[model samples]
Target: MRSVSRRSLLRGGALGVAAVTVAGCAEQEPRQAQRLAAEPPDPETMLIRQLIAGKERTVALYSSADSDRLTPFRQRHEAHLAELRRRLPRESGSASPASSAGAQADPSASPSGAATAGSQISVRDLRDMERKAAALRPRQLDGVSPALAQLIASIGACEAAHALALSRSL
Candidate 1:
């Protein structure tokens, strides 16, 4: 075998270093992307998102109900959603967690359309959902800011009132 020249050896060494550098940079890209993707949402934000999703589900349940009877109730949920969004940080993306939950929850709310196809909503179903949502609020108070806690409490009160109102309809 012919012996390698000093110039050729140096050229190969330079190429190897360049390749290693490029590889290192490429590896870091995915790690950086993973870090961004896995970042946890703040507690307050998470709670707010959950509440928004619940309200959206409530509104969806009313969609196929009698407009004259449920329209006022649906409007209250809309107002709650608006208030929750207003409390969120401005930097928070426009894509609310409600949008994602709405897609899944709306379809399942009236699975057979048996309940919703009728002129009236199932008051029992609405009351159950409202009760569950209200129950969740107390748990959500943990780790939230004082301001957020107050807001959550108010929302919970509204949910409780909604459940009572629904009970009256039955």
Candidate 2:
């Protein structure tokens, strides 16, 4: 019977471990990738998406109205939407929510409508929306980046102004 040296046995064991480790890692690579792909988006991305949806709704509401007075308001909302879109991470699929909604004469006519038909979006409705959006801004500030927080604050201020302006228009 051949005698195996301790060093030789140790070396063989080490090699076996190395081979198993390499094989295990190779098997796990795809699983790790799948897990990563399945993970939910980050907080900032989610907030940005929510903001985009709200702005889209607001723009649609403004579009539904025929008032010349609301054009600038709609334009401002559009600009805000553009900025929000720019901030969205590219890897997060930066597709804007159904931009076609912005063109509809009445938001109620669109699927997943913001308002009921025959109850046209009045100045009071817009004012209430602006007020609510502004009030929610501070809560949204937490857990966001400084730049995003600043942008949100500015937007809130603008919304507050919009609310005030809409109030005066009535």
- TM-score winner: 2
lDDT of every predicted structure (CA atoms)? 0.71, 0.77
Instruction: Evaluate model 2: give its TM-score.
Output: 0.68
Over the full model, what C-alpha lDDT does candidate 1 score relative to the true structure? 0.71
lDDT of 2 by residue, 1-170 (tens): 99999999999999999999999999999999899769977978777877887777777778877689899988988888899889988877655576323332221113233553334677777887788878888888998999999998999899899989999998
- In model 2, residue pairs whose N, Cα or C atoms come closer than 3 Å (at least 3 residues apart or on different chains), thus clashing, are none
Candidate 1 residue-wise lDDT, 1-90, digit = tens:
999999999999999999999999999999987986598667666666666665665676687565678788789888887888788766
How many backbone clashes does every candidate have?
Answer: 0, 0
lDDT of 2 at 34: 91
Question: What's the C-alpha lDDT at position 136 in model 2?
Answer: 81
Residue 143 alpha-carbon offset, candidate 2, angstroms:
1.0
- Runs in model 2 deviating more than 4 A are 1-37, 99-119
